[model samples]
Every structure is written in structure tokens, then in C-alpha cells.
Target: MTLTTLKQRSLLGLKDLSKDEIVSLLDRAAHWEAQPVKVNPVLQGKFVANMFFENSTRTRFSFEVAEKRLGTEVLNFSAAVSSVQKGESIYDTVRTLESMGIDAGVIRLKPIGVLADLATRIKVPLINAGDGNNEHPTQALLDIYTMRKQFGELKGLTVAIIGDILHSRVARSNLWALQKLGVNVRFCAPPNMVATELDAAYISIEEALKADVIMMLRVQLERHENGMIKSAEEYREQYGLTVERAKRIAPHAIIMHPAPINRNVEIDDELVEHPQSRIFPQMENGVPVRMAVIERALG
Candidate 1:
């Protein structure tokens, strides 16, 4: 790769990426999805590390699948089982992996700004799997990919992200990326959960239902005791997408969630697999979307 190409290797957040760069990536993801064979082997012998400092199911496994499908050698790291359990710093863990000669890394950490700091210090390309509440670029990419697949072009679509916004990296990434793609984005959350820093609209649940897409954020059930919410039942009653509320959305509109869903808490169980729900399709789309990202990093 040329020095200019090398400069584009690391993907820390969508905030810095322009509309064309993102659309090109989404196009690459579509190209990956169209291939006949599952394993392309384009990245044979390349090495990629999955360094997740936080607990994850979809993002971690999705990256693993994407890496192996491209024939990259994979190294999986978790704070729970790694030297970080013994108080080793995050930089030490990544630097240790760097010294071992990884070609690229996909990192998910809790501390804000840490990923950007690591990117400056680390030589290999680093992809942000999820960096605090700042961004989850690939997740947002898959989401936009899913929307484009359903609605053709993304322009003029209104997406109402309904749930906790303040701590949702998914919400932030989706908001920024979708807006850049000409989609109108808004939030519908309890007052405490709203992100005042974002430059988006805050709508009532009724107004939210009128949008082209209804995307719900996973409620952190543990926060019920935090006084922000009283209890699970109360939250479902006020904010959750109950079966009754699901019926109110336009027949043409679709429902979406970045899952590990709280089934009955954030959305009704039956609604999870509803015809209008793209929850699992988002998961299915994650692999190819990540393949595009991982391939970008190592190819």
C-alpha cells in the first residue's frame, strides 16, 4: 500500500470519515456478500487480533468469522482471561501483541480516547470494534447496509433510535453515519438517557413511530436501580416496544435493534422475529460488513 493508503488503514470513528468513504465501504460489503464461496482466502497468512476489553458476543464472534473467512490467522484476547486480570495496562496488552507481529487489530475498550491514543502509538492498523460510547463503526456500517438493502437508497429516510442514548456507542455511530448518508436521525429516550451533546432531534414515542425506521437500543437492566428508571415493568410500559406499540408502526416501516436483546424488556419476544424486525438480518449482515473492514485493514 502507498503512504496515502497506509494513512486510511485505521478506522477509529465514523465522525472523521466522509460520506464517500463510508458509501464505498458499504459497497465493498455488498461485493463480499455476492461471492459464491464463503471463504475467499484473499488474506491468507495475514494476522489479526481481536482484543476486547469489554464483554461481547456478536461483535467479537462476528470479527472472528470475518477474519477466518478471509483466511487471516486469528488471535483472541479477553480481559477476563488475559494478563489484564492481573492489573496490566491496556497499552501493555496491545504492545505485547504488537511485538509478536500482528498485522492488524480490532479493539473494544471502555475508556474514551484510549483507542485513538493507541492508534497513534501502534504501528499496525487498528479497527475500533467498540470504543467506549464514542463509536462502533462496523456495527453502524452493517446497519446502513441493512437499511440500503431494504429501502434501496438511504436518502430521506428517518430513523428513530428509541432507548438509552447516552451510553450507546451504536446510537452515536449510527447517528453520525446515517446523517452523512442523508438519513434523518432522532432519539427517543428517557430524559436521563438522552445525549445532550449530539446534534439530533429528540422526539416523543408517538412521533418516533412515524419514522421510516424504528431502531431500539438495548436497555441496560442494571440501571433500573440507578433511579433513572424505576423497574423493568415501568420501563417497558413507558419506553419498551410492547406488542401493542409494534402494531402502530407503519406496515412499510421496519424495526431494528443491535442485539443481545433483553427480549421482554426492550422489545416484546414475538416482535424480535417479527416480519418487520431486521434484528437477525443485522447480525447476518455483520459478517460481510466486518469482512470488508478486516480485509481493508490487512489486504
Candidate 2:
């Protein structure tokens, strides 16, 4: 499909996308990836703002790289040093930035549904980098792109997303995108960490390992105030992808993690660098996927 036919104006969540739109976007990403340098001047001379309210490593940097590679000038906004610390509202901050002539804004905030609200109030296209326990659309896009690169197809594939389902934007985005693309998604987490509201089937960790792909989610410690997990070791013993449990996984099954991984807690140290692990490749794929997203939004 041509870029002219792309339908999305802002990427709030994968839930707002159709299967075809997702596929087309991924195909565009593949086109970007196939090029030798992956540089596109589609967004040349435009200014994009990186407005992050929450701490991030992968999502923040990758979006910056994507913007630069696409030839767009980037304006970095730090909530820590900005007037946001002085109780400045999101609308005020965004509007102030928009008044300075930014073409689009990529935001990562800690509050859920804030992106949707901001999308309505902002004139520039808004890309949701992440929102609290809500959705991470670009992360899911790169994840699915990485899976497609590994397996060549997503049809009939079983993707078991294990751990911290109650507070994962990545898992929520993955479910919407993967399910729409004909993949069977299962959620496995301890009783306390599971979000019972989602319609996915619940399965044990052992059962999850048997799937075509296994995605380990990081346990969000910041959100756990009263200690839902007894200890890291106990959590690992039960649900972590330890060396012993990794051996039990199907030979063809691949492992994935949206990182800032908890090392030995969510996955064994050895298993993280294992041959079957797609952790780093997923990080690499983020650039092109985000390049596609930024280009589509502001190209």
C-alpha cells in the first residue's frame, strides 16, 4: 500500500487500528529496514518533540533515533526540569510547545488515558510512546516485526505473554495487535498480577513455554506498594524463565522481552543472552518500526 493510503492520524493505541492498517504499517517498516542506510527525508525540515513525563531508556532513545534518521529535527522535553514539576498541566505544556511550531509530539506519560485527552487538545499529531498501564503501540509494532522476521508469518502462532499483566502497557498493545493479526495470545501471571478484566485465556508458565513465542514482561516494582510478590527469588522460582524452565520450552519457540529486564528475576541471566532470545533484536527493530510510525504520522 502507498503512503497516501495510510489512515492513521495519531497513534494512541493499537486498539484504534485495524489488522490491515497494522500490516501495511509493518510492510512500510520492512521497506525502511531493507534500505541500506534506512534514512528517509520524508520528514525533512520538520520539528518533532519528545515529551516524556516518565523515565524510559529504550522508547525514548529509539524515538529520537527514528526522528533523526527520518531527517526531522528533535526537541527534547524533560518533565523533571520543566514547569511540569511546578504543577503545570499537560495541556499548558503541550500548547506552549505547539506555539513554538513543532510539527508533532511523541509523548510518554505515567497516567493512563492522558494521551487520548491530549490528542483532542493538541493541533500536532500525537504519538503515544507509553501511558501508565495503558498502551505502547510502537513497542508492539517492533515486537510483531521481530516475530515476523523470525517466523515469516503470524497466522496460527501462539504468543504467551508472561508476568505482570495487570500493569503492562506492552502486553495490552501486543494483545490487540497480535490478536488482530491471527495470533492466539495467552496471559500467564501470578493471581495478583493478572488483570481479570482482559478477555485472554489464563495459563500456567509451563503451558506458556510450549507456545510458538514467549514474551516475558518486567514486573513493575514502582506500582507495587504493599508487596504483592514475596521476593524476587520466589517470583523467579514460580514464573521466571530460569535455565531449567528454558530447557522445557519447545526447541522452536522463541523468547522475547520488552526490556529494562530484571536480569535473574524475570529471566535467568544465561537465558537472556541465549541463542533463542530475541531481546536485543527486538530493540534493534524498534528503530525501523518507529521510523514508520513517525513517517506515517508526519510525513
Candidate 3:
């Protein structure tokens, strides 16, 4: 079922999707990619409002392009031009947009549970592009798509999500999606930023690294305020994936990243350019997966 007419119309987090649901979306996304051009205006004449509260280049642009590719109109909303400057609540803003007859609202905000809360107020579909450090469902979908293309299958593969886990929405979503698909999941980050409170079913990094794919995340300065990271230098010294670190993986273990890399911070530049790196393709898949998501959400 397209997500809209399905009982659940909000894409707020990965926990809401089952493994089969994700695979079905991914398989459909792959089919859409093979077409090379948009053929159907499934969402024709509909309006999708891109409501972004945080700084975004890739996520926002990708969704805008994806919506237009399917023949839907897009209304771009930047926090700068909106009533947000007047201290208006998100509820009021979304209500105003819905009153204007928007078909769907895709948001990227900086507060966890904000989309879920807002979902209760709006009748149109809602897609959480990114919400605080909570979740990025589309990013996880694209990452899984890239993995399927690179490794041939997600099941039975060992995957390690390393670095900055505490503030990473991508990491959270991937853990849910990958583990659900039966991929061996491991998480490794400096102790403070590492994942905790998750199911005890999966192996921790020190143990899981014995065999699994390794995905590196960029460590930025903003995470310092989270109290999970003290300094970037310490982060690199302890958790950075250097060439020497790459040798610890089984010879065939794949490397992936959701880019805007830190070069030498979380992953060395050489490793990022390694033969197994799927970062670029991961970015490319964002287009079609998002197109699929938008279509299913608004169709």
C-alpha cells in the first residue's frame, strides 16, 4: 500500500516500518531508478511544502528535485522567510500551511519528537527529513539501497556503524533497518558517544568487528555540546578509521558513509577513497529513494 492510504501516513522514524515494508519500498525505488526519466505524474498538481528548520543542502534539495520529477509542485519554506522569526509555534505554522491546501509537508527540524507531535495536528502526510538527532528515515532507506547494490544482499552481512552515534539520526535509523533485515550490526564510537540502551541482541563493536561491514560517520564540532564528545582531536585519536584500522576488517568488508566527510577526523581521506567506499553512490541513491518516498507519501 502507498504510505498515504495505509493506516500510518507519517514517516517520522524507522521503527514504524517493518523489514518487508522497507524492502518493498527499496525494490520499488530501484525500479523507478531504471527508468532514467520521469514518465508518470503520479502526484500531478499536488503541492509538497519543504519545511526546513535546520541548515540543509542535500536533504532539502534532493526532496525538492524528487517531488518535481514526479510532476508535483513544491513550495519551498525557509525558516528565514516564515513566521518562525516571530516566535510562532510549529503547530501554528503547519496549520497555516495546511489551511493553504498543501498535499504533504516534509520537515527537517532540530527537536526530537517534534514531527510526531506535529503529525497529530495535520491531516496531510508528513515526512521527517531529519528531526534533531532522532531519525532520518530517508537517509536509512538510501543507505540500505546503496548497500544492496554494493554487497548484493543485506541479509547475512556484517555491518559496523562507527563514530558519533549519539548525535547521529542516520546511525539510529540504520541500526533499526539493517538489524531488522538480518544484517549483523555493530556500533563503535568513543565510549561517550557510542550507542547504549539498545537491544542486547546485536554484538557491540569490539566483538562484532570480527566480521561485518564498516560505515564511518563524520564527527563535527556541534556534538561537543551534547556532552558525549569532548574534542575533535580526541575523537580522531580514538575512533578515527585510519588505513591501519581498515586492515582489521575481513579483506572483503565494505566501507560506507553518509558523506560531508571530515577527511582525517572520523575517516582518513585515503580510506574514504578506498575501492570499497560506497559514499558517492549512497548520495546518488538519495534521489530515487526520496522520489519513491514522496510518491508513496503523496500519491
Best by lDDT: 1
TM-score of 1: 0.98
Model 2 RMSD in Å is 2.6
- The TM-score of predicted model 3 comes to 0.90
Q: Write down the worst ten-residue block by lDDT for model 1.
A: 1-10
TM-score of each: 0.98, 0.96, 0.90
* Global CA lDDT computed for model 1: 0.92
Ranking by lDDT: 1, 2, 3
Candidate 1: list runs displaced more than 4 Å.
1-6
Instruction: Using TM-score, rank the candidates from best to worst.
Output: 1, 2, 3
lDDT of 2 by residue, 69-106 (tens): 99999999989889999999888999999999998899
Tens-digit lDDT track of model 1 for 1-299: 45456559878889889999899899999999999999999999898999999999889999999999999999999998988989999999999999999999999999999998888788889999998889999999999999999999899999999999999999999999999999999899999999999999999988998889999899988887678788888888888899999889999999999998998888999999999999999999999999998888876
What are the candidates' C-alpha RMSDs? 1.2, 2.6, 2.6
Report lDDT (Cα) of residue 59, candidate 2.
89
Superposed model 2: Cα runs more than 4 Å off:
1-7, 222-225
Local distance difference test values of all predictions, in order: 0.92, 0.90, 0.80
lDDT tens digits by residue: candidate 3, 101-161: 9988999998787788788767888998999988999999998898888778778987777
Compare candidates 2 and 3 on lDDT and give the better one: 2
Q: List the residue pairs that clash in candidate 2.
A: none
